[model samples]
Target: MELRDLDLNLLLVLAELVREKSVSKAAENLGMSQPGMSNALNRLRALLGDDLLLRTGRGMQPTPYAERLAEPLNEALRLIHGVVNLEMDFDPARSNRSFTIAMTDIGEIDFLANLMRALERVAPDVSISTVRKGESNLKDELETGAVDLAIGWLPDLNAGMFQRRLTASQYVCAFRKGHALDKGSITLEEFARADHLVVLAPHTGHMMIEHDLGRLGVRRNVKLRIPHFAAVGHILSETDMIAALPGRLVNHSIVPFNLAWAPLPIKLDPIPLNVFWSAKYHRDPANQWLRAMMFDTFSEGAPHVSPDQAVPLP
Candidate 1:
């Protein structure tokens, strides 16, 4: 069917329908009556000459054609919306828009507290939410603008994105304040002999600590293996275990947990922490404002985003 023959408003309903799947939920999401949403779906079906969604035991499921249309449709709408609002200014002070960011627990400790404090001084009305970095759909979420920004040492998000280096971090041997190796330099043999608290978070750059150490023939006497960094400070502070973690995290915890840290015995590449946004929303005024805020607040060394560096993502 020709584009003119179809009512453009129905496309909005189609987008919501395919996204929500259930007509009732779509109607609620779009602030329309359930019957009105059903009518729109009926119109869409008649115009498209296909059963766009079929009801089964698990509620409404989109047909293959509708499923295929979801991404492109959302992308087109996002671009149109961005263009329409391109000239509008984003006043963070007045905007109550909640931004969702993706980061690891270590990032929450190292950055979130300071970011929230900065927000309170300027953008008090704005709210923030966080999702873990390793979510399987993280890239898709960022591309669709569902996630505003992703931060930390995310090497996985390298392709099809705009990134700004926030700072450089390196692994440090963190232990209790009174530990034997806390006073001075720790020898490689000492690090190898000490009890280790290993953080085993996958899809994060922290895993490289073990890989790098092992490559250099340094074996850690692992006493405990945890899946996250949230409790590392507590565990290390109360016990004699040493954890090889990002120096920033250790520094941030030092005051509160009485932690002490020294450089790792082996030299490894510095972990580059970055703030990433999808190429799709790179031109979005709100996104641009947020990116600029992040760069201004956290960037210590790297150059800022320039027109020459804004590349497209797949």
Candidate 2:
């Protein structure tokens, strides 16, 4: 028979009948009456010029033609399914879109200033909402589109994740000027003795440093635990409590507040921060544009650079 004489739905019935080996069971699987299945089977057999299945004492057995048709027919059905389900490609220059970003304190430390400057120069009307996505929740949050993009240190875990590098972040010490330790390089004893403002959110890992120090038998006195990095900076400017912050924020503090960043008394390894969006948003146009901006914002140095180091916008 020509292709138009056969229906694809009959292929589904043929496949299921071959699998189930019983007319009644195939009908049950297809939600059709047994007589209805027999009638469709008769029509399919007439179209193919073959007794596709034979009633045997054991049950129904496929004829040679049916066996030969089964594999290619299933393959063709899968191909059609995949083609019909394909996602459309995205375009950014012509689309006006909003994006929600999940960023850690360090993401703000590393990228926010330049992001604002870049927005001023480019897509100022594109609204960006920054939300706190605790490190623990990043993977599921990204996959579900609870947040479109996340920027921070790549978690030590979740290698299955998808990411792009934003920048490297170095840790530094932040204390108000004229504090008791400002006379010279801070001694380890002075650092451990000073009261520290620690951030205890699951998103912040400052406790690890403290825990490592405790292992060394030289723990700093944690004077308080606050929720956000912005809060930590504000308190450091107004009080004697010192904070260990990312280099970008400390550098920003140099101009905006009378703050000094001496080397950390105990060396902390620099964290490599990245932009991670799930494969779910990998095809979304707005997510792509923001990711491009995130990389560009980092590659073009942060606003913390001296005027001579910055490229003047046209």
lDDT (0 to 1) per candidate: 0.82, 0.72
lDDT of 1 by residue, 54-138 (tens): 9989888999999888899999889988988767679999999999988889878777777788889889999989988564578
Note the residue pairs that clash in candidate 2: none
Clashes of 2: 0
Which residue pairs does candidate 1 place in steric collision? none
TM-score top scorer: 1
Per-residue lDDT of model 2, residues 30-122, tens digit only: 999999999989988888889999988987999989999889888887888889787665444444556778876656665777887887677
My TM-score estimates for the predictions, one after another, are: 0.67, 0.63
lDDT of 2 at 134: 62
